[model samples]
Target: MVFFNLWSVLQWYLRPFIKWFLRKTTRLCELQRICYGDKPGAERSRNVEKSLMLSRTRDVKQVVSYLDNTVLERSFVPRNFPEILNPSVAIILRAKKINPKLHELFIVSFRRCLAQIWSYRLLLEEVEEMRKTHYDSSLPEHEEKLLKLWSLLVPNEDLESRVTKQWQYIGFQGDDPKTDFRGMGLLGLENLLFFASEYPQASSHVLSHSHHPKYGYTYAVVGINLTSMAYYLLKDGSAKTYMFNARQYLPNMNLFHKFYCYLFYEFDKMWIESKPENMMEFSIIFKKFENAIRNELADPASVFRINIEVDTI
Candidate 1:
């Protein structure tokens, strides 16, 4: 027994050798040294480098422009406010003027995007609560305090599960929200992952291709550039008031869509104005906007949209 124990200890001591050998085998050290500086920062820098590379792999120009034009630009729109531009009644009024099928798709996509954004707002609230918990301990209880504070630092596994499984199929038991969602009667996970992966190379690939059951949905922040810009502009602006006015018109607007429409309108207006009279300047603005959406606001669309089928259920 003693000999066996000693041998185990010796093997344990040599475990470091095994790790070093594996890292060497993987070319990790050389890769890290080349990708990051030679210091503790190497790991941190490597992680960030990987993250940035993943973020940039997408052709996100259009996405970013939409974000910037709607969310970031200062002069024209309400910052942080939802842009309500559905014009459903207007759409109905002009149904003959526009392609009904295209309009229907737009409405469906827009509503789904809005629902996803609503979830985002809840996410933001959780984030803010977490931030508050970190900075302020004035909450009534320690549990509440811990929850709010640590929320920002940690991922909300519970919330992730809730949103992911909200509209799951009747008998579906898979864990991943993206793959498990039975709505749209999607044909397995391949196409869905392909569609979303376009905006983020690494994440899109993982969400679309990863085989792990638990590693279901990638929480990609899809509309953040616009959201960030909207918040910035609406910071003490008239968007809140304007949105309230628009809401009077949308009795059927879900809370998610209500705020979303307001936000969308804000950006659409801002982008239209900022669109340069000259083609070159317009192109530059468009490019910057795309980067912001593709890189900065890496939101997952699978979780964002409201499942119309679920609304009735």
Candidate 2:
């Protein structure tokens, strides 16, 4: 009993020193990795680390604002933050010697902002690339995927051609579906394909909902509109809270796609619940939905996800 008491007393006394030592050692290792990692852009990443550290003395809000102005406004690419921030946080924690809790909050918030920036940049690149890639008849792969998507979503009906009036049933603007894709380009098509492929029953069910006699709506057109909504929310940083809270470190394409899925599902419910008079009221309804999303995202802890069961579909 005496030995146990002595050991416990020693442990209590030495715990803080042990923790400091561990932190120092880990920070050193992270520094080494940042400097010596085999990645292609080690130098550029190191430059970012230097820049971040140079501004470490700045208030959290100032740093966050700077990030918002700089990185968020830039073009997308696969980022080096995932590699850089691990050690950067350790170094910041050691160098700043701030209150542990405050230090943690700053680090976490900064990381979240960086993650949000990266996701936005990545998504922007994707959208831009898709916008530039016009649909071509020569690409068998693209044609096949489009056909497969149609088959998956509308299994009962056979599409006669790539261009058909049947496209209107799914919410295309006209007989030539490509015309509708002029704004969103291939990204709209890709989003639809993903929806149909990933959630076959849900996609079909939503299609059926689009055909309601009293309050029918265009599925594909509305989907493209929702894509624009998602893009705007992401671009304006309104979706940051949702993305940050939903993820531990960073958001990626899968997460973005999930957000799209959530929007698609929720928008359907909202439409049914509101029971608008006609398609002409779509703009009004959409504005209301956008406002609702913005309001929800005003909360720091908001996380958007598809919560409805698909088994019922």
Candidate 3:
């Protein structure tokens, strides 16, 4: 601990001098070094985010604040990218004493990183808002979505009544599934619906696994539990590596849903493979599972993809 503490203090003091020396020798600012040295995606984007946040220059710092303000201002519209980020990039270039005409690629790539970083922030707010909204039985839209989920997962059987025990067929705690969504809210429902809709066969396969008598578990209930896990991964920024490295180029609601699907699908697999004594072992296994995911996310190159083949309807 003492050795690490001393190293931290020493690095804090020498960081600026080291950056200055590197800049003098390479004739490149720290941002340029990261932007040019690293390949596109999470590693470059993550490093640029750190460099901007730690920068001493006011204009460089404004680049960070400007992107943030734009996100809060609801300016994540794709058409607004150049308008919102270009000025900030120009300001940063001037502050760093870089010739705009010479390093056009750096300006372009830096702007992309700014977009990726702030868009993820905006997406976090959007997801948290969705998670905070409690499921409402009286709301028609909410009711409709609930019904849609049932229809997607259990296609053959029709729900007899709104408050019937049929919900247990798909693994609700009681007659109604609304209360089960308390912690994750509608986000839980969204994740399940997306999985059933987008990758029907995969979800069906997992749903079938949930019914293994010796390995049986509540499907919808366990999905909500996985939803909580997905929220934590996003809330703490562990999802950034996967999000930024994704081919989507922007983190959005559907991407979040896909993330939740990945977790639910994978957790089902883990539960079966672990072959636990019973449901009492869920909490311990889930914690171990989450730790494994965190380790994977710590790698900047990590891009999570499930091996399931999407079955066509």
**Residue pairs of candidate 3 with colliding backbone atoms:** none
| lDDT tens digits, residue span 206-261, model 2 | 88899999788999989988877877777776766566666443456666666777
lDDT of 2 at 90: 53
> In candidate 1, where is summed lDDT lowest over 10 consecutive residues?
298-307
Deviating ranges (above 4 Å) for candidate 3: 1-6, 308-313
Better of 1 and 3 by lDDT: 3
Which scores higher on TM-score, 2 or 3? Answer: 3
Over the stretch 154-264, how does candidate 3's per-residue lDDT look in tens digits?
999999999999998788999999989998998989888898898888888888888898988999999898888888889988899888998556888888888888887
Off by over 4 Å in 1: 1-97, 101-103, 118-122, 135-138, 143-313
lDDT of each: 0.32, 0.66, 0.87
**Candidate 2 ranges beyond 4 A from true positions:** 1-83, 90-120
Cα lDDT for residue 231, candidate 1: 39
